[model samples]
Target: MILLLFLVSCNNGSGSEKIKAAVICTSPEAAKIGIDVLKKGGNAFDAAVAVGFAMAVAWPSAGNIGGGGFLVGRTAANEAFTIDYREKAPMLGFKDMFLDEKGEPVEDMSTYGYAASGVPGSVDGMWRFHQKYGSLPWKDLVQPAIDLAENGFEMTRDLASSLNYQAENLSKTPEAAAIFTKTGGFVIGDRLIQKNLANTLRKVAEQGRDGFYTGEVAEEIARSVEEKGGFIRLKDLEQYEAKFRDPIRFNYRGYEIISMPPPSSGGTALYAILKSFERYNPADYPYASAEYIQLFTEICRQVYADRSEFLGDPDFYEVPMQKLLSDEYISMITDQIKFADQHLTSEQVKPAKDLIAESTETTHWSIVDEKGNMVSNTTTLNGGYGAKVVAGSTGFLLNNEMDDFSIKPGVANMYGLLGNIANAIEPGKRMLSSMTPTLILKDGKPFMTVGSPGGSRIITIVAQAIIRVIDYNYSMNEAVNLARIHHQWLPDEIQFERGAMSFSVAEQLKSWGYELNRYSSYGDCHGILFKNDGNLQLGISTRSNGAAEWY
Candidate 1:
């Protein structure tokens, strides 16, 4: 098979400066796999499917088939769309599923073990994209992943470190333990292979979505959940389907910004942030200056407050989209950012009617083909080695995305973002997500595709990237590599990547009475910018083991 031949071939790229097609992913192997698909006469969609599956094998910490996500793409014909493959609550799930008899969240029920797993949508999602835009055979798109899983790949130091970090939890699940831990424990350079997962991928390749959502695979998932005292059933898997939705879009400084809509709070939050920022000219504030950072932080807090009060799955709840995105509303929020020396108290930035709105451990990749087709995809298992439970015999990690729901009305989820009833769990409902796979258009043509993986911070990182490129005229690399900060409203603290602000700037923010927290890194953003000259510029995060290659 062509896939096998490519698999055995040396992992080398032409590295031509004049290359047109390109792919940037959080895993080097996944990026190469995507480029291979592009090289084999596939379009951006085909390359996306290949990269999606390949990441599942090479970067299981966040990449996954047992989880779900969103895909935003612009076809060569200029049609833009978003596919919401986000995981759905199982049929047996309920608003209080995670709550104990005492009306408190049960310990670990919504974040760990079998009970946390939602009905996964990734396979169905990928298959749907292939049905619409793929040129390569479905099996061909999946073969590289099967080969990688069966034949094994060298464990990177990052993967080894991740394994060790999750070793205690992974040890609880025998299937996960066997695959992630060696006899002497996991180590860098070890040849990590998963025979069961390879077989699982083989079935998926041969049978398509049914290969995993029904028959043996489905039965195993149900049995595992039941055996572990959870509630998922085979019917949930049998009924799973990925939905196509209109991509949420807004004009930001004349650039059309496209992103996934609700069940993702990302689009609305992003739109709100960008629109609010439009009131202030970036040229007026030096980038990352204390004044600039303070203004950005204040606006972020307001936007996130709105998110907690209004964002939810439109299918299940009535999201006030028109009101939320109104020019008046944006201006109202923008007006809240006052003098740089002053900060808005949490009380001043109130949520609407006290109503509800809405991982750092996800994977995102950007792909652009020579034909003007582009894809921005963000997939996740909802935390590193999600749920710490492997479905029996499947060798895939199930997402703890149930934690994404409002287990308690005012309580925060794993990401520390609070939610209201609008985001509470319901049978067969998709939980709200922050996965913002975005594609920016210039004059109705693809200009940039970007996204990141950072729990609630995904929206902020993506928004910053857009501002860096469109407003500040930074190259794709500068946009992605620029230091970032996040303020999710409830925390009331500014979390900035170390060096994102200089010591003077940090101290200045502190002096202004803003709580500041620093981290070595925050999110991993991968992006591809299409230069007007018809060349592709790629940017992969420095905090990750990803790669950028074009040909």
Candidate 2:
């Protein structure tokens, strides 16, 4: 294990000028795995594959080897590819799963019970992306995770903290509790380790994914969930396949933004927000002032308003992709953002719902290689502990992402984001998501590598961070550490991160007629930009335990 860690830590890049390379991920273990890939002469895709699996073991709740997610990458040749491995509903799904006897939303059923899990796609997605663009073979890619799991990777402070925060929820399931608990639940600095999940990773490495999809592991998942009154079946497991799709690319002012399209409203909405911001400059007013915040929150409100009413699985819904991305609609939205002092009430939203607190179940990583390839990915299991159901002997969590759909209009989610008809529940469909993994380019060269893991706030933080770096002249790290502010539309209250916003700007926004609430933190963003000298400038947000390594 020590030898493997040493191998992962060593960086021996060669060739013309020793091309700069870096990878940003949630765990040091995962970053080390990425380094291993680079050591093996693997490109960014191969490194991403190695890090993806390693993160599954180190940051299980968000890493999601058994769940699903989205990935966008550009190859050394500058050709881009997108993989949509997001979880899908079982074919047995009923539209009324979220409705109660009185037709009111049964939120608890979707958030915590047996019916919450979706058919997983995480492994399939990683496998497919790696197979197509990676230098390492699939089995070789699985080897690192196998070693980490089999020998038991040490728990870090961040992992320990996250585990403790989820003790109550994780302890509910015997399988999860047995692994995460020792004595009185996981202590903040406890070393939580897993032999079963490691063994499972080992089996996949040697026997292939078939060892999971059609064998004993699948039985354990089905039996466990079935015992809990769930609907997961062998067919769901065997039929899982990751999808390859074209990414949405659009011009935002002078730069080009590439990101996941629909089924994910995050990138679309972010693109729209930036386009609108381009129409006006923060230079015109004091940055973070009340006036600036007023306009900022209002743009967020308008974009989320449309999301609640019209966003959904593109395959099942029209989504008006063209209409939403059109300059006309964006102009219309920007023109309506008023900074005058005022709180937007439910009455103000054409359609509305009583909102609630945000939910989390994801992690993100961004990387860039000297060869000019870039990767940004977001993976999740829908919430902490993920349906509180582990895949029995496999020790994998099932995603509750299915609850992201709107069973009824005017419904509030864990994120306080409103749900409506456009995002209605369906079988074999995906739920709306705010995992915005993005790449911004300038003059056909990589300028920024960025993304976030926050649920609904993912879009806001990424947008704000990019603006901070490119427009406000903040360094990559400063941009990420700067204070953040968010407004999720239906709630109609602006939530600001603990510090950094100018008091005068906030006061100006409040006086301009906005309702403000202060939060200890918002979504954290990580990014890297190319300096004119050709050196790499990367920043990881302090709000998260994320880190960036360059060589």
Candidate 3:
């Protein structure tokens, strides 16, 4: 169940509820900074930039200047757009790079070092959005990050937890150990500082991408990755830019769904889920009942199967995003879900156990300005601590996105999906992603802002929430907080969150040959569910210590 918890801020100074602009982020300070831009008369794009930069600090594992992501937004006139800034494979990358001595491919390289790091585009991506729609000055957008970096921001409990969790791995990398982990051990509480990072932010603020790619910051990044024997080069830094594209919008029941297109698989994978499930409504079955789980899991299985087989950057492959999401196609896929509890194997679903993952720990942000514009952006460095290769010069973490490439056709990722030839690595090819930033429209007006940060589960979680809100009568909070159950098909097991449901739901389901795994948190999702009259309601899941605020 995707749970949406709305935070209500009742003003004692004035009882009247303002027509406030709201924001949700993995970091509270980041959300505040985003709302500050809105209060300053900036548009949704500016708020996205502010929120993203702040998340890089507070939720570094997921959000990074050294990474890339996707954005889906709506203009004042309700014109929908998608920005695809996901990282690309370096010029040096090749399909055989991850293979072993026996010519067998390995998956760790995609989540590990130089060969693993993709060209970073997040900085250029956010800057492009700002250039097109920002009302606030770029310098102003960069100020909060600069101050937080140089002057220092207090470490919240969540920040402390992330620091401790990644500390050991960081110690293995010289640069990361020097800055993030103190001399004795992990930097915790109030002692952590990012002086060098402040300087890096100031450089970008003062000189834009040139400050990062061709100037001092670029030198720093090149040096660190080079020293580590990784492949990212100065040229890779100079060539990166965020690409903008049209979003793929589909009708789910009656509501419109808009999501980022490739180099993001978020849209295609999610479309499959919606199209597949339109055949059955959970309301038709008891909540958390075996029938419901079986139905949802089958929908998920089919989506992953296709994702593993055909999904890739559209620039490289012809992704039939529209046809796949078509009601006719979905009916064919979803109708296969048996009411009886059962483990649908490769033989059951056919084709494969498709898997896709970009480190499960990432950050998602959504914002809507008073101009009636909405923006949803998700960023990730891939995995906790990323490559653990912090550039000594800039105090920035590099990403591990190179893994999205299909090292060799038929090989499976950790999630268990066999790769297709289309996703194979080539010099400068962008890695495919599942980061689905989305915008929802009610009668051509921005009504709800939604997105998530769960790697491969990002598609499942975001797609499920869309179903809950538009299909069921659950409130936004209830819809988001619902006990979300996940099955990607390949694993042949349904993963459930703790407090999901009663035992009968699992026992009866288990009798049908299903393996169930329980988790505490699936992903950090932040969204704003707006009432038609413009009343703002926000939800921020605690999976990543995320928060929401109305400004």
Candidate 4:
């Protein structure tokens, strides 16, 4: 299960009824499946697995068995764990795999074709999670997804629109075109079913991880990729394993922050970004004021500068975690912004320390049971309907995560995020990612579980949400509903949601030499906040076509 928990909430001074458990995700059907698992006496871990699989059937845009992501959680017993199920380059993969004979990168080769895929680890990741901490039968946990795929479900407008928008790319694969764009295009409320996906889910339910990594499923995945000029081989599939690592733990004020580690720049970048504000409390500045935006943007510039220069897969490069998160490093970052009254251009900030190194088509869910167990997971296929191609007869979309690797040093990925040799493609190497699955603990107890889907903006989006609750004492809902902003160092521009800043504030920012880019919105954030009074407050982003269900 992909679990990244962010826990922090205020009671809003109301006597809300206590909740025994909660499930929040991008799909109502998936959320219901998770609640049912809790109702069936399953723990948060079990609910997480159920929800993760159900998303594959209910929300195919980002959720998947053909992709991989990170999971971070804390058990009722106070044990913390993180599973790195990130996809890896196939064994046949090479540094220049996406480059042409002219020594230039072929954009299409790594963004929308078979060569874009990586060896998926979601199946093995969920199985590892279940085996480690789940309290229910593995088969039972996955049955809900199987049922949904087999019996079909009502198509929502968002899903239908997404399918229609991607018709051209998806049409390249006969299987995808047949399943997603049938009858010219699906309308809202149309019944959509996937017999092939249902069959694949059955194999997983019956045989656990082996069902997909071996046997017919594996053969077909490899054959399809190789036949289309991709590099995946049977050996790559058979050797794929999800590794468990210690959660990245840090104390932000009084609350304990837990998040994913290397291969995912989220945790490290988040820590750097958050710690940079230790001396300056954002609460002191009015929301979206010129002062607040300047402070926030400057800090983001410095941290993201570090992210581009020094963050990458730990197994492939030595991430300077100690130095990056060190008190000295954070102090250096904060000191720069503390004295600066104007916007700091990207060119003005560079990774202070010399080092190495990482999509927006991702999904996140949060689950918290009454027992004090909490799970926050972020999973993705690297883009909407990833690679725009389904594995032949498998009924799953493949991830274009390989593009996440820097096709060439200093080159920007699809998300407009830059990287270097530290994140270059290599045989069996995991690509760097920005998926942040986080958990917050207050006084050693579960406080909240939160996560989101926003590609490169994920780290900053998550950080902003946590700040709203922790510093401003906003309710979970308020924190999520509030407009958000992002600033990656390379672009040297600030991206704000349409309503994130007032017109005057936008003009002020521009006057201060900050380029502002506004968009409708991004990120489908879902979180469960455990209140001091023992009530659970669920928060779902208004921008999401999802729900928050609890019992």
Best by TM-score: 4
Q: Report lDDT (Cα) of residue 248, candidate 4.
A: 86
lDDT of 3 by residue, 351-439 (tens): 43222214577778888877788898888887766677777678888888776667778776544556676688877887777788888
List per-prediction Cα lDDT, in the order shown.
0.86, 0.75, 0.75, 0.85
lDDT of 2 at 239: 89
Tell me how candidate 3 scores on lDDT.
Answer: 0.75
- Residue-wise C-alpha lDDT for candidate 2, range 1-551, written one tens digit per residue: 11111112122211223328888876777877786677667888888888888888888877866778888888767787788888877777877777889999775788785688888887778777876887877778778877777677666666677777877887787887888756554545455567788877776676666777768887887787788877778888888777887888888767888888888887788877888888887688556766667667777887888888777888888877777777877777776665575445435855222221124457888888778889998888878767876877787777787778876777677777787766777778878888888888888888888888777888888888888876777777777668888877867778887774677666766676667788766455677777666766666767756755556
What is the Å distance of residue 138 in model 3 from its true position?
Answer: 0.8
Off by over 4 Å in 4: 1-16, 338-341, 354-358
Sliding window of 10 residues with minimal summed lDDT for model 2: 1-10
CA shift of 386, model 3, Å:
1.1
lDDT by residue (9-50, candidate 4, tens digit) is 322225444566888898889988998899889999999999
For candidate 4, the TM-score is 0.96
Per-candidate TM-score against the hidden true structure = 0.95, 0.92, 0.93, 0.96
> Which runs of model 3 end up more than 4 angstroms from their true locations?
1-6, 9-19, 183-188, 341-343, 352-357, 414-417
> Total backbone clashes of model 3?
15
Question: Could you tell me how far off, in angstroms, the CA of residue 501 lies in candidate 4 after the best superposition?
Answer: 1.3
Q: Candidate 3, 392: how far from true, in Å?
A: 3.5
Model 1 TM-score is: 0.95
